[model samples]
Target: MKLFFSYLKSHCKTLFFAGTSVVIFCGIFALDNLPLSAVGYAALLSVCVGLVLIAADFLHFRKTHFQLLRLAKKVRYGLDGLPPAQNRIEADYQTVLQELYRGMTELVTDCDCSQRETEDYYTLWAHQIKTPISAMHILLQSDENENRSDLQDCLFQIEEYVEMVLSYVRLNSDNTDLVVKQYPLDSIIRQAIHKYAPLFIRRKIALHYQPVSFTVLTDEKWLLFVIEQILSNALKYTRSGGSVEIRLESGNTLIIADTGIGIAPEDLPRIGQKGFTGYNGRQDKKSTGLGLYLCRRILSKLSHTLRIESEVGKGTTVKIGLESTRLRVE
Candidate 1:
């Protein structure tokens, strides 16, 4: 009924013109002294014709209206499901849709190409740089008489930066090599500590680690990277003779507390953000600002949480909430 009324409203001007013409014709007939019954019959016949024409137009309009509604729904939900156009106006709309789809497809293709190129370049560059790094490692190892501890440290830093590059590239890749399984939490912690043991010895920082028997479901390689990054940061800021403690608390939380210069309060919140270096980093001038950011991201991927508490001039405590029961295979 609403559609019928709308159709009538749209054709009101034409209806008015038709009615006026019929009245004029009847007036002419009346002026010629036509019989009243004859004139009335002609007027009724004209109105009947007009009504039939209006009904036909309403039916056609209703069909078009329903088609438009269906087309709109298909365009919004599934463009591929849109039916073929049956009218000129619908054909024009379909042409515009095709153009838009083509443009979008081209844009997506270009973006994918650009991303692949970038990944290839970085991957190749990382591999090329490793050759010299490996050669330098061998040389540093062979030259024991030269007291090459500083060279060894620099080499380690270089390797870390290279690994960071590879990790950053892979982090955005479509296919990530993640192997998740149940592993001994203590074993992972030990591996991380062993990797940084040389740094601890060189800096004379005391280590306090307590073994905890717990199994956690995670990608061990990724978790080790996170732990190493955290440990590296703790060691970097900590003074010589200071201590770093690793212990497991209730609720399966792993706490790594360091007797280092704590982070500033205002900078604490933004530390996890990529490329964010606060007061401590600015003072040290050696921070890459990616360590904690990477740690946070990796732990989040492993369904764990990292919470930090710090006070300037005191120390920093990093809490890793490992809710093993909530783990899932991804």
Candidate 2:
């Protein structure tokens, strides 16, 4: 209806002129004393022809309008260009649109290149920094002193930070190195527990983890990163005497619960969000608000899910669903 009204509006001047001509011709005929019935028939025929032409034009106009709308929505994907030009004015509009499309494609290409270069530079920098970190680790290990252990802990934290940096960069890269295969689940968990063994010992935190006799299909490296990150957070918040437990439940989920100061109720929902540090993080002043965020991202890519349950001053329990789309429990 709207299109019909708009079409009529566009040709209103032509319609008006035709109607006026018909009226004037009838008056002239009556003044000359010609047959009134013949004049009436001729006028009726002209009006019917005019209506048919308008209907055809409206239908064509509607089809073209819808086609342009679909093409506009898909222009960014380069799926198709604008519909073929109709008149010279339409051709000029299409010519301008084509030039704009070319310019847009060039801009997108340039931006992609610039972004890749920046990611490569930072990724390289993250890798290069590991060398000095390794050197420092060796030097620190060679000495025996009261502060050696503490210094080593600091170095360990630095290494974790660097790993986070590398992970962050790679996570956003256009290409990711994810090797999915079936492997012993305990193997990945063991690696994370082994790395944090020193922290557990130093903090006097009890670790209760039994070997999980299961094999899961996932990217081992990325999954390991998520496990380590969760464990790191567990240790960071748990007091010296608190305990951390790792267990597999219902055969398709892994739960890591910590008897640490739990998340504030207000902050629980926002735990994995980027740069979101809740009440506890604000107190410790050491939280980067990236660990959980990275873990969630990695898990999602692995066809896994993460859910957290916590209570302030009690503890936080992180449950990771290991069921992939390929696996059916029933």
* Most accurate candidate by lDDT: 2
For 1-330, candidate 1 gives per-residue lDDT tens digits of 898889889888998898799879988998999899998998898879878887887888888788768777756443675556768998899889888978887888899999989988998999999999999988888898566998888888888889888887777777557788888999999998988999999989999998889988898888888888888889888999999999998958889999999999999889889989999878878776887888887788778899999999888999998865555666
lDDT of 2 by residue, 211-329 (tens): 99999988889999999999999999999999999999989899999999998888988989999989888897988799999988888888899999998788989999997875333
The superposed Cα distance between candidate 2 and the true structure at residue 155, in angstroms, equals: 0.9
Clashes per candidate, residues 3 or more apart or on different chains: 0, 0
How far off is model 2, as Cα RMSD? 3.3
Q: What range of 10 consecutive residues in model 2 has the weakest lDDT sum?
A: 321-330
Error of 2 at 187 (Å): 1.3
Each model's lDDT comes to 0.86, 0.89
| True lDDT of residue 158, candidate 1 | 89
What is candidate 1's local distance difference test score? 0.86
Question: In candidate 1, how many Å is residue 155 off?
Answer: 0.9
Model 2 residue 258 lDDT score: 99
